[model samples]
Target: MTRRRSLALRLIVYLAIAQMGGMLLLVPITDFLISASGMAPGWEVAPDDWGEHRIYGLVAGSVTRAETGEAILEPSAALGAYLETNPQARYAAFDCSGVVLRGSSRELVDALGGLDRIRATTLKFKIPGDPDPRARGFLRRAPAASGACAIAAYSYRFAWDDLFAVAALFLTPHSAAVVAPAVLCALAIAWIVVRRGLAPLRSAAADVAAIDVNTLHRRIDVEEAPKEIAPFVEAVNDALTRLNAGMAAQRRFTANAAHELRTPIAIMRAHADNPDDAVFRRDMKRDIRRVQTIVEQLLATARFSMRDACADVDMDLGEAVLAMVADYTPLVIESGRRIEFEPPSEPTIVRADRWALECVVANLLDNALRAEPEGGVIEVRALSTAVVEVVDHGAGVPLAERDKIFEPFWRRDNKSNGTGLGLAISKTLAEQMGGSIGVDATSGGGATFRIGLRKSVVAPPIASFGRVEPQRAEGSVGARRGTA
Candidate 1:
């Protein structure tokens, strides 16, 4: 990725440039203000040559040749209208030999260095403000081809179009003197403001950079942040909070899984010392089964949460429960108990992942068996509403504990069986298949774990939801002792 430019630096640069540009442009305008305010005589008058240049303009336009080729003044013409009121008041033209020209008297010529100089340059004059009406002015000599020099004086004025003369007004040594030091100071101030204004953002960035798994709980101080970015900082802190929780849960899960596995291994190692004993063989088998159950529960939990792990398919609720009850019957009998199944009154179809559903049902059955008293009949039922219930006459779960039991590694007491992961694994698998499993008090006295299965579409053939089987009604289902 291309590196981003600094916004603070760019803003500071822009501000400094604007200040310098405005200052440079102000020089010509300041001259205009002074000259127009009649203060030109008091301060730097008329920007140094504007009045002298204007005097020469009148001399150039109004001077003309007489029939005898002599320089003469004609202020009454259209180009000389500015002098119409007081033509000779600011006008003078002198011939080379101190001879009085047509515009001004010999007394004015004496003031202009009469006859002593062959040619004359611009010379400053106060030119009385009467009829010319502005206090400050300048005089300049204009010579015609006929060898007559004319002197004219005028006050200054400012115009609107004078503003576009950026190069003429600003590209000067005088403008440079005012602009350089001021621009340097302006730039320095802009840099300082930018740095101080961005201090909070820099602090927030430093806080974020320091965070790792162990420090995720630390948050950026929102009080110090500007309102414009407070929401963004809060969002980052929220993400960190979630990351911290997930990491902590993962660590606890890993440690608990290890501890559960080690206990069975220790039991099996003791059993190996009495290999020939029947009790040792039995106990070894039981311990190995416990280890296998814990491993399977952990595997199911970790993998089922993956997006592609669920293969949802339409299955008949009665048929699936009947199958589960059949598989779990032998285990129930071996434990000196019985299992029963009840089919739905009508065909009930559900969408579920086959492997995930089996694991969930097996976990439910395993949990029931552990809680059931000897010779107790464990019941499996499929209601017409696409629900499966595993009923056991064990101590019913308390209301508060029901929600907690679905959490990983939560158990009622230290004597809890099967790693306390069966219900958690079942919850994970059911949710992944877009189904729900919950427990309530069984009637008469026990825990009733109910599964609300996903509604299945049996009409339109879905290639991924598995093949739909023909509905076959059966007699009241019985797995072992009693008809469910």
Candidate 2:
């Protein structure tokens, strides 16, 4: 890209050029005024014999007696005497009748085509030279003391070369050395002023950059901003205010929706679980349980989506995993699947909300059980103090679909039994707790879902609990009962 010139530099250059041009114009006008005033009264000379001779005047290059056309002084001798006195003069002559008296400069007289070619009025003309030249002349006819016609004509040559030379002085390196510093100083002052003027804009930009969903309440300080930009800043603050209100409304809607659905889903689950007919009870319970899972996932998603929803509580990773696995173990076994828990011997403590961590672990176990085939194994293992992994012996998630799996309402197979929000909620919960969750292919032919949490320095207290084993009756798996 072409670099643009600075505004201050451009302005300085334009102004300087205009100033120099005006100065140059004055040069010619000054010279013209001086020439006009100098030539107004023509050169005069008196000879010793002219007091009684009544000599009127003598025309240049003409020899004549005053008023008689009698030859007296040769034009050459008379012109030589005048030029000897004023050698620098361009034209000087006295004319009487048809005879003309010329200066000693023969070259100038020949250039003006002798005094005969000279007009009896002021005129300007170009002088012949290698290149070009010009001159200005004035002629006047006056009366002498003897009543004879006295004519005097003077020509002033224009010094165009000298004029150009004077003009060029201002365009030289020395002139640049003088003007450049002044221009630069002006530009520096302008830059400092401009930058200071825009300081408020820079501050506003920084404030705008800092704004996010969490800091939506912050606004640009319109009063401190420059007047020209205050309106724009105000508009931006207004937009942020509107956006904050919209987000608040969305959050309220999600919370209200979750709250409104919880009671009905709980009632449905209780009714489905106590049906008289065993087959109807079993099917209704499964459907109601699916609805319950959907409701829980929706609520979890809404809860974790909030910017301020994080609870700064430390939790035991092993305990959270063990509890979730224990809760889902009975359901997994009832569905003809087996669940294995391999928690660490020591408490794996991490900084997170207990409920959010439980939600993430439960969602992972639920997804694993749903993916596993009949008689397949679901392993819940604490891979590290801060990481818990769930490995299932079922068709693993495809490489291309792994990322999409964590998106809300995105199902690979569109299974009616799954809400598709389970993994999404798990991801949100993990992020809210400053953790991460991801899926990978299992070694054998299943998927392994890993959850990484921030490890806590403090260890959690241990509690004793009895384990439950699955019971089989008539080739159908029964719910495991836990005892104290």
Candidate 3:
């Protein structure tokens, strides 16, 4: 998979480059204004020159031109004479017309360099044709053609090369400060625009990725999402709605068909057995009962499995368990298994349907009775917060079969004569009631089946009236008779 570049780093890089670029252009703009407005007297500026300036000063000595493409050397001889006359003649230059023709200041003229290095080469050839305003004023001549550069060259010393070198350094870096912020601002604006524009795409992708078959009945709440993504969300939700409706119709048809077939099977089984054959009749009756249990469990599973569409209310879980126990006592006792129950001291109210909670308890008790050996004990306990546990002393199920026990028709031993749907039905019912059921190892060394239900918020009475009469703490209600 290809990785994406980060928006922040890209923003920083682009902004920095833009800032540096703007600074480059800013330097020339600033140079034009500063040099133009700050011109001084004796400075010669020109029309065709764009933006360059040069200035000159007063005369201290003179030089006469000679004809052999060379100077007469009068200024050198004069300078030698002046040096002899005064030991303190420190620096000098020959300014002629509007330009400096020669100089004696070592730092200035040596940097400008020797006579042959001066391009125009002679005293007569090196002057501007017309003086600029500042130059005309300084020279005191309307036309600067007659003198200033020559007079100033003989008078004072200036480091022209040094002045230019220093100006270039200060000007460029200074221009960067003035222009960088605006360029950075523009780039920042661009980044915000890009990120904001892409937000809808990100949200739509998350919504699409989050969709699943289990949640197909749910639609994205597009009114609460970004406007740009509303249309796509609507389209996806429409597709999901159609798929869910078709699936729901198919399930309804299958359940209805199965239910229709059950009545005919029951009628056929009733006619198949002859009343005269006692043994055959008893076995046929048991088989028919088994088939009836299986059909009832199937119907219950299908009804409760559509949990998302069901509405539940608060129910007394303790009462629900007690009712099932009372109804199943005959069957349990007939099987020769001792069934014991521990009711909570307080009402254990939970959020669930009364019928659903009863079904769950009935299925669990039935499983416990069947699993326990004849004359063995089955214990039931209830607590606050709607928790109930039914335990049985039997050949406990293997660890590997625990998970499979909750799957439809998954019997550990096929010869046990069970429909194998009890636990599976109980699981579905518990989940529908917003609860859970599982088997855990009992502290007393048997398998304890636990049913956990949602706790209620209201304060419950200490008594709720459906409990059986009190019995001894450690002894069965009828231990000698083997009744619990």
Return the top candidate by lDDT: 1
- For candidate 2, the per-residue lDDT at 460 reads 61
Backbone clash count, each prediction separately: 0, 11, 8
Cα lDDT, model 2, residue 72: 43
Largest TM-score belongs to which candidate? 1
Candidate 3 runs further than 4 Å off? 1-272, 277-285, 304-308, 443-445, 462-484
Q: Tell me the lDDT of model 3 at 457.
A: 77
Model 2 ranges with Cα > 4 A deviation? 1-277, 459-484
lDDT order, best first, reads: 1, 2, 3
Per-residue CA lDDT of candidate 2, range 1-484, in tens? Answer: 9998765556556766665555555654464455545654442311111111111123323433556654343455654554465344444344454443532245544565654445454343434562422223334443344222333333332233334434554566776676667666665676677667777888999999999999999999988887899999999999999999868755754664565456556766676677775576566667667667767866665655565577758766666676777677668767877777666545567888888888888888877877888887777777445888899878899999999988765666633346566787789788888999999999989999999889887856655333455444432333222232
Question: TM-scores, in order shown?
Answer: 0.56, 0.43, 0.43
Candidate structures ordered by TM-score, highest first: 1, 2, 3
The superposed Cα distance between candidate 3 and the true structure at residue 386, in angstroms, equals 2.0
Give candidate 2's root-mean-square deviation (CA, Å). 20.5
Tens digits of lDDT, candidate 1, 1-484: 9999998989987897778667776655676677667755677555433434444454566666679876676654643554453344355565656465565544455544533254447655553424544444444566455345545444443224334443354667987787788788878887888889888889999999999878877998999899987998999889988888867777887887788888889988888877887788668867877888888976775685454678888887776777788877666766777777776665677899888888889899988989888877788878767789999999989998989999877888877776677888888888888889999998999999998888787752222221222222222224322222
Error (Å) of candidate 2 at residue 110 is 73
RMSD, each candidate, Å? 11.6, 20.5, 18.4
